[model samples]
Target: MQDMIFDNNQVLAVGSEPFLSRFDLNGKILSRMPCAPQSAFSVSLHPSGVTAIGGYGGLVDVISQVRSHYCTFRCSRT
Candidate 1:
């Protein structure tokens, strides 16, 4: 795991294995999502609750404002 951030009553993580995982405030795993780069290493959240996932591959995924579920986002550069 490279980096993590908290947002929207949940913890978001990006790393090698789980790729992306969401955890509750109590530290229980909520759900696991697939990372585009597969080897994502960093993550951040926008004010709108959108998650920005960054990988060593110089790619970034901007997840939509996720509430109960992370529907989708567009991928771009580092």
Candidate 2:
């Protein structure tokens, strides 16, 4: 897994296909979801029940209430 965050007695991890997953303390996967096309590198939870996954190519996936939205940014190298 590339990144993980613990909340509400569950573990949220981001990685390969099924990029975002939630696991119980016993390591059983409770739920899984796709994030970005590229590998996810970070995961964060919001107080408002929103989830954000950051990945390559300046892509970020935001999930709220079972709905997903992708945001992108352009980066320039000097």
Candidate 3:
């Protein structure tokens, strides 16, 4: 795993093929998302209740962290 963070009693891990995993405080994985062919190497949680996911070929996926309220945008470093 490249990195991980604990939020709201949930542990989020990122790395390798298991690009991301959501685990409870008890260490049981609740959900998971494998990396694509592009390969993700970095992730960040934003204070605006959003997550920024990045990968090869300058790919990025930004999603709202809020459950009830969320949004998406197609943005890149270019």
Ranked by TM-score, top first = 2, 1, 3
Superposed model 2: Cα runs more than 4 Å off = 67-78
- Candidate 3 residue-wise lDDT, 5-78, digit = tens: 77788887666652557789999989775543145667777777676656665555565564322333334665
Candidate whose TM-score is highest: 2
Better of 2 and 3 by lDDT: 2
Candidate 1 residue lDDT tens string, 9-78: 8788878863678889998998887766667878888887677787765667667775343443445556
lDDT of each: 0.72, 0.77, 0.62
TM-score of each: 0.72, 0.79, 0.64
Candidate 2: residue 46 Cα off by (Å): 0.6
Clash count per candidate = 0, 0, 0
Each prediction's RMSD over C-alphas, in Å, is 3.9, 2.5, 3.8
Query: Model 3: how far is 21 from its true place, Å?
Result: 1.5
Worst 10 residues of 3 by lDDT: 66-75
